[model samples]
Target: ITAKGKPQISTMRVIYQPQQGVTIVQWQFEQSIGWLPWEKLGSIMNDKILGPMMEKNLDQLRRLIEAETSSL
Candidate 1:
């Protein structure tokens, strides 16, 4: 998804794969740094924000899956 009022921005793509007993969530980040000096901004945002957010989302998914599986 594109953000508001920004030309050079970052976007994320997510995919999920069902494994034998677990699900793998893949997060891909794409950043557009046209005419930028370095990739520091992109790296910092991924490391600080995206990484933690993905981790939390995965943890929540795991809990929900486990709860449903236990009920079945």
Candidate 2:
């Protein structure tokens, strides 16, 4: 629960798949909002709120992976 007394839940998944000779990485994020009217309304803004942050995080992860593998 948040300080506002609303329940919040989130999940993240990372998937790796090998196709031919290259590996692909994919991720998913999900959040559960409480059953309050305001919460439901606020859910509408979740994508706009979270998209940029998520993209930044993914870019960091990609850079880290590239740096780590460059020597191999």
Candidate 3:
């Protein structure tokens, strides 16, 4: 909630890059809208399929968001 008592949604994106062999992750949030709402979300990615790296990144993201929100 904000000072005006409205709710907000936090968004996250997980990206997987192959060939070069690495992954990238990003996070963002929505705040103070007059009406429209956005969904708070999570996602996963992998080089070939939903494999180890994907799972690992997803787990890390979950932990990160959990820890961040828990403090609020």
lDDT of candidates 1 onward, in order = 0.62, 0.70, 0.57
TM-score of 1: 0.55
- In the range 20-41, model 3's lDDT, one tens digit per residue, is 7656665544444553333212
User: What is the C-alpha lDDT profile of model 1 across 8-46, one tens digit per residue?
Assistant: 444444445556544555555555444554556665775
Q: Which ten residues in a row are the worst by lDDT in model 1? A: 1-10
Q: Which regions of candidate 3 fall more than 4 Å away from where they truly are?
A: 1-5, 33-72
Name the lDDT of candidate 2. Answer: 0.70
User: Which segments of candidate 1 are over 4 A away from where they belong?
Assistant: 1-22
Give the TM-scores of the predictions, in the order they appear.
0.55, 0.61, 0.35
Ranking by TM-score: 2, 1, 3
Per residue, candidate 2 scores C-alpha lDDT tens digits across 1-72 of: 667765665555655555654555555555568788977777768777877787888889889988999978
Clashing pairs in 2: none
Name the better of 1 and 2 by lDDT: 2
